[model samples]
Target: MNQAIDAIRTFNRFFTRHVGAIDARFLDTDANLPEARLLFEIARLGPVLANVLQAELGLDRGYLSRMIARFEERGWVARDRLDSDARARPIRLTQAGQAAFEEIDGRQRDAVAHDLESLSATERDDLVQALTRARLLLDRQAPDAFTIRDARVGEVSQVAARQSVLYAESHSWGHGLEVVEAETTAAFLRNSDAERERCWVADLGGVMAGAVFLTDEGEGTARLRLLHVEPFARRRGIGDALVAGCLDFAREKGYRQVVLWTHTVLEAARRIYARNGFECIDTQVHHTFGEPVQGETWRVLL
Candidate 1:
C-alpha cells in the first residue's frame, strides 16, 4: 500500500510538472490555474448559481465569492439576484470573459497537441487508452458519472457487436452468440413499441459502458434482456443501475413480472438479478451457444 501511494504521488508530481501546473499563469493567461478554471466553468455554465459552482468545484464558499468578486471588478462577469430568491444569484460571463476563456482553451489545446507530437503514433494511442482507463477508474465512484438513456440510431448494432465480441472472447461462445445477438437486436428495433418496450444504454463520459433492454413479452410480462457492462467498466454499480432502470420501466408499464434467461457461468449478472428480487425459477442443460451449459431462467414480480 505504501509503495502504491508513493507511486501515485510520483506520477502526480511528474504530471503537474509536465503540464506546467506549478506556474502562476496557466497557458500564459493572466489568471492562475484555479482562476482560469473558474472562468471556463462560468463560460460553460453561465446563468448558473454561485453555490452550484462551489459544490461542483469543491471550492470554499468564501474563496469562490472572492474570485467572483474579482471577476466582477474586472468587468468579465456579471451576477444577478434570483427573482424568486434574493439570496441566490446566477453568474454569467461577459464578452471579455468569453474571449479570455477561448484564448486559454486554445492555448491548452495547442500545448497538449505539441506534447503529443513528441511521441510516436503507437505511444500516443497507448497514452490515450491509459488516460481512458484512469478516468474510468476514478469516475466510477461518483454516483452521477454514468447515465442511462435511450439508445440512439445505429447504437443497437454497436451494442450487439460489443456483446458478441466480449462473450466470444470471455465465454468461448463462438459465432452462435453473435448471430443470435444480431437477430435479436434487429428484431427489437424493427418491432419495438416506444411506450411499452425500451432499450437503455449506460453512458460514462460519452462512452457506452453498459446496456440493457426491457421488452414486452405479452401476457402482462416483460423480458429483461442483454444486460451487459464492458469488461473494464464492471464493479462500478453500472449493472445495478441498468437492472434498476429495467425494473422501473417494467413497473411504469404496469407489467406483472419480469423474466430473463442466462447461463450459469455469468455469476456477476446472476448476482445482480438475485439482488434485484429475481428468483431462479428453472435450470436446464443446454447446448445453445456451442457448449453444453446449464441455462437458468430467472423471474421477478414487479
Candidate 2:
C-alpha cells in the first residue's frame, strides 16, 4: 500500500512538472492554468453558464465568480441577460476572448504534438492507453466519454488480450484463459452472422475497455460471451452497458432468450447479468481457470 501511494505521488509530481504547472503563466499566457482552462471552456462551451463551468472545474462558487468577473473586466466575456431569472445569466466569449482561447489552445496542442514526436508509434499508443486508464481509475469518468460500437478489424485480438490480462491480474487466471479467449474471439470474427451475432466494444476515448459478444445458439436462443471490463474501467456502468448492448442486439435479432455463463468469483459481473433480468438457472463445480470453481449459467427470456 505504501509503495502504491508513493508511486501515485511520484506520478502526480511528474505530471505537474511535465505540464509546466509550476509556472506562473500557463502556456506562457497571461492567465494561470485554472484561469486558462476556464477561458478555454467558455470559448468552447459558450454561450455557456457559470454554474456549469463551476461544476466542471470543481471550483467553489465564489472562486468561479471571481474568475468570470476578471474575464469580464478584461473584455474577454459578456453575460447575456436573462429575462425571467435575471440571476442566472449565460456567459459568452467576445472576439478578444476568442483570440485568447485560440492562442492558448493552439500552443498547448503544438506542445503535446511535439512531445509525442519523440516516441515510437507503439510507445505512443501505450502511453495514451496508460493515461486514459489512469484517468478512468481516478475519476470513474468514462461513461459519457465512451461509445459502444461494433468491434473493428484486428480488435478481436485487442479485446482478448485486454480481457486475458485483466482477468489474470484480478483473479490469477491461468494461461488457458488467454488461449480460450483468443480462440473464441477469432471464431466470432471469422464466422459471426452480421444480423444475428455481434460483438460490441466499449470504446473509452479510443481505448477498448470492455467487450461483450452475442452469438446465436440455435432455436431463438442467443448466448452472451466474454463479458469483461478492465478493472480500472469497472463500476461506471461499462460492464452493464456492454451487457445491455448484447441483450438489445439479441432482441432485435428475434432471439427469444439470452444466456450467459459466468463464474461465482465474478460477483460484479453476476450483478450486471442479474440487473439485466437474467436469472441463475444452473451451477456446477468445475476445474477451470486453473482451479476448482463454482460456475453459473444465467438466462433471460426476451
Lowest summed lDDT window (length 10), candidate 1? 136-145
Candidate 2 wrongly placed segments (more than 4 Å): 44-55, 59-95, 116-127, 141-145, 168-172, 186-196, 216-221, 235-237, 251-257, 275-277, 300-302
Q: Which pairs of residues collide in candidate 1?
A: none
Candidate 2: clashing residue pairs, number:
0
lDDT of residue 80 for candidate 2? 95
Q: After superposition, how far is residue 235 of candidate 2 from its true place, in Å?
A: 4.6
lDDT of 1 by residue, 50-166 (tens): 888998899999999999998988888987898799987789988888888889989999999998999998788668757776777776554537788999887888889999989
lDDT of 2 by residue, 222-277 (tens): 99999888766666688888988888888888899999889888988898898999
Tell me the lDDT of candidate 1. 0.88
